[model samples]
Target: MKQVLHFINGKFLESTSGKFYDNYNPATGKVISKIALGSEEDVDKAVEAASEAMNGEWGNIKINDRIALLYALADEIDSRFDEFLEAETLDTGKPYTIARHIDIPRGAANFKVFADTMKSVADEAYQMDTPDGGIAMNYSRRYPKGVITVITPWNLPFLLMTWKVGPALACGNTVVVKAAESTPTTTALLGEVMNKVGIPKGVFNVVHGFGKDIGDRLTSHPKVDAVTFTGSTPTGKRIMQSSALDLKHLSLELGGKNPAIIFADCDMKKAINETVRSVFANSGQVCLGTERVYVERPIFDKFVNKLKKAGENIKLGIQHDESSDMGPLISKDHQEKVLSYYKLAKDLGANVVLGGGSPKMENGLENGYWIDPTIWTGLSEDSAIVKEEIFGPCCHIAPFDTEEEAIKLANDTEYGLAATVFSENLSKAHRVAGQIDAGIVWVNSWFLRDLRTPFGGMKKSGIGREGGHHSLEFYTELKNICIKM
Candidate 1:
């Protein structure tokens, strides 16, 4: 079995605690690797290294030099594209095609996009009259926020990790990354690329462990200046409390119980196709993935039937299988959690329109952590299945008679991460999308992202935006200086 260790100060080191956690492949229900479980001591070492690098060589490097290193890092990651693809697939059990086209490519693209954004970003300058009858000029200067502790989730581990790491590095802030325990392989592999690209030692570090063990230590560390986390709302709350002690700069992208509202005037085929992808893409592990769908009453029945057919067609297979459309959940524990929700939906009098149980597997995949892509209806709006973030390949669809009801149903939850409106009526699309409480609202499409746009949630979904200049704002501190002529 492979043993994955921590990458600290440009070297791979074993945990001082001598404890290890089994890294399982969801497709086979087998242990693929043993990851070192880090302790507070490990976090301290990584933080110390990051602080040293931030105040030393990395801090002194010019913006142009930093941009050059970022580009080189992006190129190196692109060069090893296949390696990253395989690692991401093996770690997450997502389809090879999905990992190849979306995860790996976007992960590398984040670096170049942030590098260019850093190059083009400008600060403010103001000219004012001085009280001494002389002219005064005020200009803004941005500096790195010091050691950034990044906590990433397991679903889109590579892409999301780089989303924060790219900007943190481009803005000249050193980072200590705590990748999710279940998907640490690709994150560990990136250490090799960091070294190969000649990024200075201690500028980037990775520590492996559960959130409770060392996560609290890293977030609460005195030397750590900021924390950017993408995970569950509960975890985000805990980190927020930890950050309150030092008032560290914190950016959290939390959970979402997103909705997709399908209007009667929508392009039927397009609405059905894109909504299906939105609900089950990456087995519905995406933070922006839609779970609660509200269809206009005239087309509700037809929409449910078409969505059911699409859910039935989803293929469940292991990594390297080109024929698979989707794969298993992240782990057995997650499979159990999702399955419990299915049972709850049934118990809550849900009308199961499609799969409600696990699918049969063969060729040594019988023990895999698999669940059929599920669809449900007839559940109340306030039901647990409809209100909570299950993060599974499932959705509970309901019908609404009016545009006002559609908006009400969509925004009825505490989470305001993302939503989709399918309407051919441009007026309704604009009007309904404007009323939805999500930070990012999509019309007639799902999961189409432009890196330059501001991205975050409106409510419990997240705090603070990232992407383009928004990310630069989070990673750096802007200061205004006034000088008299």
Candidate 2:
């Protein structure tokens, strides 16, 4: 098996603790690699390297130089696109088509867009006239926060890491990234690209391990100036509490139990297709997956039937197979968790309109963690299945008679990450979108993202916005300077 080690100071190093953990291929249910289980000592070394790079050569490099480096990294990533596609598929159990079409391309786009966008950032200035005839001027300058800890989850490991890392590095911050142990392959490959592109030593570091072992140390370390994490709400809360000791800056993009409201006047075919995509894409492991769907009463039955047909047609096979529409969940534990929800929903009297159990597979995939796409109806609004984030290929749908009730049902959950409204009535689309309490709302589309837009959640979904200027701002601090003349 291949051994994956930490990347510190532009070099790969084994953990000081001399311990390792297994990394499994989700599709085959077999260990493919061994990753170093980093300890607090490993985190300290990475942080120290990051701090030195931030204060030394990297800090002194011109903005144009930084932009050049970013473009070079992007080019390197594009050159190795096929390798990244395979690594992401093997690690995350996503279909090869999805990885090739979405994940890898988007990772490269993040770097390219952020490199171009950072060129447009300008400081603010103001002129004030003094009462005593003296002129005064105030101006703001943005500066890096020095040594940030970027912790990314497994589902979209490379994509989310670049989403945070691109802006942070573009803004001149050094980063110590802790990739989730389950999906560290592509991220390790990223370290190689960074080194080959000649990004200054210690400017980027990757440490792989379980969260409890090294994550707590990295987040709470004194040398680390800030943290950007994408994970579960519970984990985000713990990181928030731990980082509060030093009052380190934090940007968290956490969990969601999102909703999709389908109106009677919608394009039924479009609504059904997008709704199915929202729920079953990436096996419904997305944080923005629309777990609770509310359909307008007049078309509710028809919509359910269409959605059931769509779910039944989704092809589940090995990740590398070109014929597969969707692949397995990340691991056996996660598959069991998702399957438990299906049982609970059935026991609570929710009608399983489509799949409600795992499907058996032949060949070597018999032991793989696979769950059939499932759709449930006849469930109450407040049921556990409706209210919780299943994070799987399952959704519970119900009917609403009025636009007001649709909005009510959509915003009923504590999560406010993302929501969608399908309506041909432009007025209703805007009006309902305004009423929903989600950070991101799609009037007639799903997952259509622009890199320049503000992205994050409200309520328990997240703590701060990311992408575009928001991300740049998060990685830097503003200082106001005043002069008298």
Q: Model 1 scores what on Cα lDDT?
A: 0.93
| TM-scores, each model vs. reference | 0.99, 0.99
* Regions more than 4 Å wrong, model 1: none
Q: After superposition, how far is residue 143 of candidate 2 from its true place, in Å?
A: 0.5
- The sequence of per-residue lDDT tens digits that candidate 2 reaches over residues 1-485 is 88999999999999998999888888888888899989889999999999999889999999999999999999999999989998899898899888888899899888878888788977899999998998999999888888999999989988999999999999899999999889998888898999899899999999889888888999999999999999999999999988999999999999999999999999999999899899999999999888989998889899999999989899999887898999999998999999999999989998999999999988998888899899999988778998888899989888999988888889898999999999999988999899999999998899999988999999999998988888888988999999987
Q: Which regions of candidate 2 fall more than 4 Å away from where they truly are? A: none
How many Å off is the CA of 316 in candidate 1? 1.0
Where's the lowest-lDDT run of ten residues in candidate 1?
311-320
RMSD of each: 0.8, 0.8
Pairs in steric clash, model 2: none
The TM-score, computed over Cα atoms with residue i paired to residue i, of candidate 1 is 0.99
Clashes of 1: 0
